[model samples]
Target: MNDYVRGSAWRVPVTACQPRPLSAFLSRNAQRRPASAIRSLLPLEQEPGMISLLAGKPNPATFPIEEIAVKVRLPDDASSPVVVAVTGDRLQKALQYGPTAGTPALVDWLAQLTSSLHGRPLPAQSSDSTKPWQLAVGNGSQDLIVKAFEVILDSGDTALLQSPTYPGVLPALCVGQVNTVAVESDEAGIRADALERMLARWDVDEKTSSLARPKLLYMVPTASNPTGTSTSLDRKRALLRLARKYDFLLFEDDPYYHLSFEEATPSLFALDGQDSDHDQGRVLRFESLSKVMSAGLRIGFVAGPSVLVDAINKYTATSHLQVSGVSQCVAIAVLEQMGHRGFLQHAARTADFYRRRRDAFERIAHEILRAEPPVAEWTSPGGGMFLWLRLLLPLNANTAEGDSFALISTQARRAGVLAVPGVAFLASSGGTSTYVRVSFSLIGEEDTAEAFRRLRRVILDL
Candidate 1:
């Protein structure tokens, strides 16, 4: 027999390799691309101070608005509610449908804010476009994340998520049927070595082989969701280098960027030089005004290659038109009032407040509850709202044998203290966990002591 015929004898039918019509593909394939009306215009607007014949932007003059005042006392020494004002034509633009990507002024201000905060310049466009790496606002960071995932993950396509990640991303990926590869995280966030190993042996790894190649790696680089770990600068460089070597996208879900405990760690985006090398479309950084400001405001944005952003905006336009103009207006007003330094000061106060709470809780966990020779271990969050704790139970906690799910849900609730279970954070079923996630952002100082006391009792009983 001919070599080709003999080799092909063991192969499946040739129809498997035959090209099929687009109509035959799965529903996700039909809906794989991004949808955003506003995100598309980002390129045209980038025409470096170009005038508009393209955008149907409502003139600010036509918009009817005078001022929007947010009543909240500034942190620091300020003693009264600082009513930030949004006046003039700027207020009008904010109140109207405006642009799909975002209001020009707001996007500009955000780009500048990101640059100043991260110590990187605004991304330079490949071609001398008026706009470079611009901004597109969403209801919150979650909004942008859903949109971004839609743009990249197809049905059955793969994504890499750090194990014990934010619970929010779970449902979104599930609804889309995207296969998630859980990469274990160390105290330093998503393990760079694990990521590289997985990618290198994709075909060989039994866990990864049946799935499609992963097109994106999702991570919260600063104060990661459940672990409260941040990737070091060296790790960032290594991750970036590996992404370049492999050509997959890096979804940097960094809403807590400002809340980092390390005041001076380098941001992944800043290391990519504000994404000047669009080829490294490798890093797509997501930010939000939620955790730092107010979660109710529902404002967040993504910065990366124009191509990807445009895809996302396509999904946005077809669905939401644009994020609420009213929210955009309010956010722009607040940002303009705060500028860069004032904003940083406010953020620093918020971060410091959470840090203090973390310190207090850790001390109590060590002193009172752990006094009986310790029953749990936890990583100290540098900056962010949560402290992830791993309980040492006599039973098999990893398999949920002695997991805290029932303890916190039933016993702890009865005890008047509540927390999220570690199983909720685990992406897979078989993986064992003895961990529990606690949020310090919403809890008050007076309640903290009692809460830990209640938590201690549950562990002792277990």
Candidate 2:
């Protein structure tokens, strides 16, 4: 009876549950793994009056660089620039090998930052009680995404993913031999009806009968890649209810959370933490500095239940050892210079920059693609860099259904325009699609009209 409460947000009973022990879900390889001897000793060095003779880290004094300075362009002018510097102790940390989890200062700063942003309680150091959550730094969110899969999946384990999802995740899923089930989506992102139906019939369905019931649901919720759609607050609550019903973990990969052109919706992580009785166990959220700050820095942080984070850290210990110390140090210096308020202000400016690009790109698309006897249709994105276009093309011999592959790879390329064919984002291979993904992120302002013009010509010819 403790597991059910009536008349909550779902119009269904809220399920009171605890996360399954992480050890029960870890892969065989992860279960057999050992901690890095050097990494284990890193904590002893922190004790007062203690000196480390252990790690083979090269002396920072041997490094040649004395200081590093970064020039940040002003959002409005670009004529005036501000300089942020890394020197003294910070510079020393940059040049040396650091802790596998991350540098202490950056880790603590991100912990507080995430807590404030997501409305969650800060994780405490003591382990006597059930610690609600923790954070881990990775080379990038992409790196963390792969590791998360490794931690949870065996060779044939199943995972539920949104349709037309981020293409980057496909290869990682393949590498882990994880089976992916696609959940349908609409303009507001993943549809709860489709997801609920899939889960309800999973065990009895012939297609999924042999496959293990999925324990994880991977989603990009805000400004989903390729689709350019965001999940609404009502939809998020519905999805979380399904997650509770199915007892599955939700991986919220939200790199574009801060890049919304309109007001942002509450994230699944934030929503899950809203319950006063539960801190968080069902949602693991990822954040990145790539889009907001610098992609080249390759700094990202993951926040979730401590049990899951501990497994990810164990994998990190043996794998990359740690993210590049120089990268983390550079990130920390820039973040400190910006401070919390300034960082948010910078995010708003970045969003405005993309909003301009989206406006110009959409105007051209409407003029060219939405003419008499329209050649294509698309959703105007509220945020992020992509425009997902469903092309109106004739059916070919290769596919009974209209597909964009030849039009994009062959015809569009010859016409001097590039776009990713939609089939690449599907859960399974060799499917036909009339959709294509066009990006406005790095495309030039002057070339927007011409690019769409060329694409229109190609479609008209087809």
Candidate 3:
């Protein structure tokens, strides 16, 4: 035994000690590595105007910007249709070579907003010695989502996901050839008991045992897709504990965090800040302006420890170069204009819109379709744009013996309603689920009643 491992403290440490040099540790990561071509020029990008051999960034001149206008038609009683002009130097930036991490102004604005809204420590990036929080921009949160997966998930590596997860993640994971293990979820997002059970016996699960150990937990903490559920603060804490205990990353997919039905469900990031030794560095959070603003803009961001973010950004460098300069500039301009309070108000507006739709849908379903209430149960999402419905159809109904996929595809479509099937969201051969996902965001007010009526009929027939 070494002297460091001696006396009264002569007892062996209960926890395993595994440490490696930063370079050695990183070299082990095969998933994300900066491309050789890009790595060679890092120092050059910092060099003083040396008339460069560098990024093949598009010439700003090629971008056409004859005119850009946004017309708002809000309710008459509400604030007069606010229309802001976009021109001058602003228009030029929107049509030029922008920052790699995002427009500096936009990055700064977002950092401030995240710090204030989530109540996280604002790292000072100036004369003050505080560690500055870094930022990276991407084309919509979806772009960031794919990049995050690329950064850590090796082909065949295990990724823990919530049961009845976001259907969007399915295709991406399939393309990556990654193995996912579903953790049963309840009204409060992923269930701690179920996660503990799955993780505890991971090495023994026939389906998962052959794959590389799971290094990530993918979850949408607020208004989860296919199952509009938000995990409570206590649940969040338990999850953090589990992550720390098992040594894995927590991918907090929280695009809908701001849309919570409650005044505050409190973000994992926010709660992590409460403790001094809080290794919040484990949770990588994702957000987007798509749900809050317009999905067309394709602007999104992720927040995590500098090391992980750097790894993901390196992938971004070789893959997409950077999110569009125009988009970043526009986002910055709009975000700066909205500020913090205005942004919150706008978020509330978005939430209010969805909540109303949810109530209407639930009311119609209860009155017309659900013969027994608890027989077909679903969490009333506190926020976001989805309502995951778990129907009470026979597990082995018709020729099919699983999800509402066949019914929705044939009957519902024939009946003129389209909803995502639950099986589409699960791991292949995971299990049978009598669930279906519905989105209120895409539908209009006048069409809601008819859509529900169609959906109700399909369930009644089942």
Q: Rate the local accuracy (lDDT) of all candidates.
A: 0.72, 0.82, 0.69
What TM-score goes with each of the models? Answer: 0.83, 0.93, 0.84
Question: What is the descending TM-score order?
Answer: 2, 3, 1
lDDT of 3 by residue, 32-130 (tens): 354648544654666677777676667756767754556442333246665645677777766765555677677778888888877876666653112
* Winning candidate number (lDDT): 2
Instruction: Give the alpha carbon lDDT tens digit for every residue of 177-260 in model 2.
Output: 788889899998899888888777776789876677676889999889988889889989898888876667899999998888
Span of 10 residues, lowest total lDDT, candidate 3 = 2-11
- As a whole number from 0 to 100, the lDDT of residue 278 in candidate 3 is 45
Task: Give the higher-TM-score candidate: 1 or 3.
Answer: 3
Candidate 1 per-residue lDDT over residues 1-462, each given as its tens digit: 111111101111211223222122213432554434444564575587788676566666654566777865555445776787776666665676656677777788888888776666676644423334556777788888888887666666677888888889889899987788888788877788888787777767798766666667788899888888888878888887766665456888999888877856777777776455444345678999888887887889988666566656666777777777778777777666666777889988878888888887778777765677577788788778888888777676256446777777898898888889888887755555678888887777668778888878877876
Q: Model 1: number of clashes?
A: 23
Model 3 quality (TM-score): 0.84
Mark the 10 consecutive residues where model 1 has the least summed lDDT: 1-10
Q: Model 2: runs farther than 4 Å from truth?
A: 1-19, 73-79, 128-130, 277-279, 397-400
Candidate number achieving the greatest TM-score relative to the actual structure: 2
Give me the displacement of residue 318 in model 3, in angstroms. 1.0
